[model samples]
Target: MITNLERFKREMEPARQLYTREIQDFSKKYDALGEMSMEEFPDIDTQDYIFSFEKVNGASEEELDEIYIEISNHMEEFSRTHGIEKFCQNARIWL
Candidate 1:
């Protein structure tokens, strides 16, 4: 039987592919985002989470902007298809 984690992994492939190379490399470093789960994300809107993600920290602001746009759209779709709680619990935005 496919576990939820496996299913989530499979489901995320296309969204992952849509990510910019910068984001793809970032996500890959997180082990397919196994570490992205939020214990208690305080934001009611995902936009807040996206906007506040990773400091510029010498990274390109242009790159971070692109990452935010991609994540905002993709994450909303994922949450709609899945459930709010499930989706939120599974991923976080950080770099």
Candidate 2:
């Protein structure tokens, strides 16, 4: 029988694929901008960040929280290094 974890993973697969594609597109769009500082991209909206994942049917609250935290941390670092606009622009998961 399929486990809960397995089912959850299956449900999240589509969102993950979408996130990857969005990020890649954002990277390409900004590739010509060159290294930009945080101040350069002042329109970044962190309220609805990309890494926020919808809860899977069988996933526990704890599991979803962990996933969000992991993604948030990674995205935070990425935003700091790559600018918040780039981060927000590529954030299609929550969009």
Writing each residue's lDDT as its tens digit, candidate 2 over 20-94 gives 554444433322222211112112222222332333346566654564455445555655564443434434333
Cα lDDT tens digits, model 1, 1-95, are 76665666556545444432333444443222332322323332322123134343355666656656676566556556644534444455664
Off by over 4 Å in 1: 1-26, 29-57, 85-95
lDDT of 2 at 57: 46
Instruction: Please state every model's RMSD to the true fold in angstroms.
Output: 9.9, 18.1
Which regions of candidate 2 fall more than 4 Å away from where they truly are?
Answer: 1-52, 85-95
What lDDT score is found at residue 48 in candidate 2? 23
lDDT of candidates 1 onward, in order: 0.45, 0.42
For model 1, state the Cα shift of residue 57 in Å: 7.8
Score candidate 2 by lDDT: 0.42
Worst 10 residues of 2 by lDDT: 33-42
